[model samples]
Target: MTELVRATSGRSEVALTFHGAGDLDITRQVLAALAQHGAYVTVLAVGTWLAARPDAAKMVLDGGHELGNHTWSHPALSAYKPEPMRVEIERCRDELVELTGSPGAFFRQSQGQHATAEELLEAGKAGYSRVLSYDIDSLDWRDPGPAAIRHAVAAASAGSVVSMHLGRPGTVIALPGILTDFARRGLTVVTASKLVS
Candidate 1:
């Protein structure tokens, strides 16, 4: 599988990936907005988030989008020793597999940090084929206004993997404009797997 920082699809399509570790209400709003646009996205969910709200994880999959592992508690895997790093990756993979009945297709490092060589090997050992990083970060975590969020997403080009968060209300608020911008640019927003595949 490709090590994806940006999708390399030969089409005017991009992936909108949401990191799910924060507010559930905002997550629901984000999902609803995507559904309204008839857009499918990838959600890299925290294992603990899924454990606390399996229903939300189900909601993502049931909506016909893809869900992926984002570690157990959003820890920095690079800071940990090898064994604990494996646990961080594997525990999330296991939890997602149990909840979804399949090991997810991709793994994203916490905070959009690229995995180190050793960490990448650990991810492979944990059964993940691709480690997803992003080309465009929405910076929604800063509680930036909707306009700023829209501007960040607007800068994404074709085959871009745009990082966003489910924890922030600004992201939810910016969804309509983001979708509109993509549509206006004739860029179809697809799930990350679909974009890469």
Candidate 2:
């Protein structure tokens, strides 16, 4: 199996990970916000986004960012059996391949849960080598306030994979600040592939 090349530069690095939750507006804002900084971003997109919002999917791909599968429907992988899990993963991958014209080589399992290594193998079989397992939990998934989001990223370090959601306003509001903070600390903000490559 081809292993996703992780960044071993030994310099302090961090990946700003965003899980795309069918939110085109948020994704657009994020891309625009990060472009000025030349930040490398990883966006995990759901299969439904392709059919329901192709425009959003196109926007993400057009940003020259790395896209990863987030499954057909956003559900915990631990909730389903192997066949169903495989189906979900593949469906998302195939849809992404069709839409973006690139087979998704990375994945971020729904809710960050994988019951076993077999699941990782399944991902590998589907041509996904890099899987994002977060290091910093922004808790933005819980609909927290901006202060909380700011506080969490402020504590990130090199190689830290920050979990964020485009669905949350707090996260969006906090992102610009986070990027500025990363700059102030002399750390390069990169994609998840950079962390585990």
Candidate 3:
């Protein structure tokens, strides 16, 4: 069985989730960071990105991370018709199954935005067990410096889900500090599944 870990006390455990695109460098950094802390991470990989970056995808699996569907491209599901969104979601799931050969049960909306709970229900019907969103956003995609990433993660509390990108240099530099800080605060870094379960 997977070891249980918690992000904070006095509440449901916090979740830290990462959304990854095709950028291997960023994904590698994130995986490395998680490994250093002896933790597993949740990765929502774009379907096309995974197809194009098999090496990186393998790296993530080898590092003991959980994979989730992030659609074929990073389209805002809210802006699309339900059929289109459903197609995208299924396509992502199929591609992930092909790449990792593991049945993934989580789906994260592209851009962290979904049209409604109905869309999430549709994903669930398609075999997704959870929909991920974040309470703490690193906003590293905005090119924030290391301090910004540090500050964002430091604000984490029990049950807070942090959003971060795999493609940011500042995030790489800030990862160690973030893990150490969480540990110092008596936070147990864990994968999203563990937190939610």
* Residue 100 local lDDT, model 2: 81
All candidates: TM-score:
0.96, 0.89, 0.88
Least accurate 10 contiguous residues by lDDT in model 3? 1-10
lDDT of 1 by residue, 14-65 (tens): 9999887776777788888999999999999889999888787888998889
- lDDT per prediction? 0.87, 0.75, 0.74
Give the local distance difference test score of model 1.
0.87
Candidate 3 lDDT tens digits, 1-21: 111223334653456667777
Which 10-residue span in candidate 1 carries the lowest summed lDDT? 1-10
Error of 3 at 14 (Å): 3.5
Residue 71, model 2, lDDT:
84
Off by over 4 Å in 2: 1-8, 113-115
Ranking by lDDT: 1, 2, 3
Best by TM-score: 1
lDDT (tens digit, per residue) of candidate 2 on 1-197: 33232344667888877787746777778888889788878888888876688776677667767788888898778567788888888999988888888766477778753325656777777777666566677888877787888888887887677778776777778888888899999888877766665
Q: What is the C-alpha RMSD of each candidate to the true structure, in Å?
A: 1.1, 2.4, 4.0
TM-score (C-alpha) between model 3 and the true structure: 0.88
lDDT of 2: 0.75
Per-residue error at 100 for model 3, in Å?
A: 1.6
- How far out, in Å, is residue 3 in model 2? 9.4
